[model samples]
Target: MLEGLMLGLQSIVEPQHFLVLLIGVFVGFIGGALPGVSGTMLIIIVLPITYGMEPISAFILLTTIYVACVFSGMITAILFRTPGTPESVATVFDGYPMTQQGKAGQALGIAVLSSATGGMVGAIFLIFLAPVLATFALQFSAPEYFALAILGLTVVATLSGGDLIRGVIGVTIGLFIATIGMDPLSGIPRFTFESAPLLSGVDFIPILAGLFAVSEVLRRSRDDHSIKDTFQKFKTKIFDFPIIKKILTTLTRSSLLGSAIGVLPGVGATTAAMLSYSEAVRWSKHPEKFGKGAPEGIAAPESANNSAAVSAMVPLLSLGLPGGATTAVILGAFVMHGLQPGPMLFTNEPQLVYTIIISMLVINLLMIIFAKPFITIFSKIMNIPYSVMGPVILLLCVIGTFAVRNSMFDVWIMLLFGIIGFYFDRIKFPLATIILGVVLGPIAEEEFRRGLLMAGGDLSIFINRPISATLLGFALLALTLPLLKKVFSKKTQPPPVSG
Candidate 1:
């Protein structure tokens, strides 16, 4: 293991490789710090740009950006209440509160420290346990995958921003939107209304752009209030080992949760972050303090998000299964470079696997080294006027969605969703739930069909397979636990007073 890692490090130590890693991190920081843009979008846009580059160099650069964006999300979340990515939504709960309390620097420091630890833990797991985990991952069948998606969908109830009903509504809307394109099993289209573009289903980029970025821009546009604090500086450094240790503990828990979820066939980073945050809240001594400036709040989701980012690579590299949309994109990148990723990847191209792992570690170290001094500078992005910044963000959204297929239709779809997103925001709907539905809906549909076919359309098939049964059992627990808690709480509580 050590020898392989050393060989990998040697490969990445080349000047050109170092340059690729540096460029990726730099781009990632900007992408993540900018509101309305995500690391995934940046990577998708840039994938074509890396067409002629060596496979290793391209993957190294892309993964560096992927990892860096996870960390840089804290910048916007802490300085402004706006989250740069859905994964950082939990960060805004506590991070912005710290900023409001004049502890922006301290919050930023903690976020960076926690994200590094989370990312490092994830990288370590990828390096050491990818083989073992891949074996377990292969055990999943269609029913099991369906159950996993169901489990993820249930998290919407917990992450409904304290409004369980609204969360359910948001999830329903998301599911409906996901159904807009062609039907998965049948050739007949469902809700496209005869538009050719709609036959492909709603594009993830445009929907996500509308839901997250454009909606946020509109929401921020309505707010005329200015921040009261002239940004304050704290002497908080990344090397504060005591704080780092505490942050590590929190990140470790979240990372483990994320990795486990990512190893599952269909669930992805968004669900991992949401579930981790919910678990963090459940485990906290003061659960009510969560979403009200609790440090653990930020740490949990950041850790989970980064961990899921890495673990998603595992299935793609080892099982020839893309764990999520981003990993699917990465898989395409690998194939473009004439490399096939699967179990044979390890034995056939051990050096390539190790190089990817080592590059992750090195890129993280470089990101931390570079992000420290600029923490204060990046936090100042909060001061930019909403009017000036919002249009630029919208423009980027337009460019990103259009760049995906170079289709004017996608751009129009983005604008249409932007309006839908604006209304969803006004109605207190959760965008994360919608994105999860879109990402996971097809998986659920495919698996549900496959499982039924295997059982000859017998409903008992869900219980016939042991793995399927166990997964369904877990899904039931996920669904019922919240209701059980509420029921028990109500039983123990006094009646409300009349107004």
Candidate 2:
């Protein structure tokens, strides 16, 4: 293990590899900071460029970009309520609220540090437990996947900002949004209403962009404020002892949870981040503080998403399975290089596998440095009055939404949802619940149908399998947690003092 680690270090720091790291990190930073650009998109654009490089060098470049992009995405989410990628959606819940409270520096610090920590933890797991995790991941068939999605849905209760009923309603609307377009199994359109564009379904990019970004601009137009300069407090000190101590448990738990979830093929970092945020809320003593600038809230999703992004490589490197969309693209790069990533790849090129894993860890650490100056510079955006910033943000939302498919229909959908989001906020509905419904609904539906097919519609397959059953049990726990917290708070409350 030490020899492999040393070899990876030697390979990555060589002048050519080192230069690629700088370039990759720089490109990823800009890509992720720009709303609507995803790590998958960045990697795809660079895929042709990697063709001329040695296979190992190419992978190092891609891996660096993926790691840096995932972490840097929280920049916009914290600074503005814009999630640069779907994976950072959960970050906006508390991160932007922290910005509202003049704690933008602390929020950015927590996000960056937690992301680095999570990446290191995931890299360790990949190094030490790839075989075990890959074996575990393979157990997640249709039934288990369905149960996992159910567990993810239970997060809606926690994200409600204490209004479970409004949260449920928001989610109902979101599920309807998810069911638009054709039925995956039957090839029948459900909610298109005969519209040609609706046949393709509403993409999450536009809806999410509208939900957080466009609505935010509309809201700010009502009462705009100049951004405060909080750069001095934005320390890149990775081992900030006080903040680390405050969120150590949430960070560690989320990292482990995200790493475990990321091992499953098809399950992306978004789910990991959402579930981790939910679990943090589930276990925290002050659940009500979650959506109101909680440090734990910022740390949980940031760490989880970053950790999941790294551990996602395990299946790709070990079992010839792509862990998520980005890894699927990375698999294409592997093929382009005439290298297959599976057991044989490991057996044939042990150093190569280790080098990729080690490079991921190195990149995560380097990101703190890579991101620090950028954060300092971006912090200056706070000085831009909303008068100027609002129009620019609104434009970003429209362009980002339109960039997804280069279709004006998407832009219109985003504009429509921008109004809906404004109304939802007017009524104090929790935005996270709507997002969760849209995100998890399709996963649940697809997996549930497949599980039934596997069981001849017995319905017991979900409970008959231990992993599936355990996850379902966790879902039940997630649902009842809010009630449990309410009950506990009541029981522990002292008698009201006489007026």
Clashes in model 1: which pairs? 181-201
TM-score of 2: 0.61
Which regions in candidate 1 have their CA more than 4 angstroms from the true location?
1-20, 34-63, 75-111, 126-130, 162-165, 181-185, 225-237, 240-357, 376-388, 497-499
lDDT for each residue of candidate 1 in 321-380, tens digit (9 for 90 to 100)? 555545655655675567766656777777878888988777667766888766656656
Model 2, residue pairs in steric clash: 227-382
- Model number with the top TM-score: 1
Worst 10 residues of 1 by lDDT: 225-234
TM-scores for candidates 1 onward, in order: 0.72, 0.61
Candidate 2 positional error at 245, Å: 14
lDDT of 1 at 204: 68
Q: Which has the greatest lDDT?
A: 2
Per residue, candidate 2 scores C-alpha lDDT tens digits across 105-167 of 788889988999888888887887665554465557889878866775665665576777887
> After aligning candidate 1 to the native by TM-score, how far in Å is the CA of 402 from where it should be?
2.2
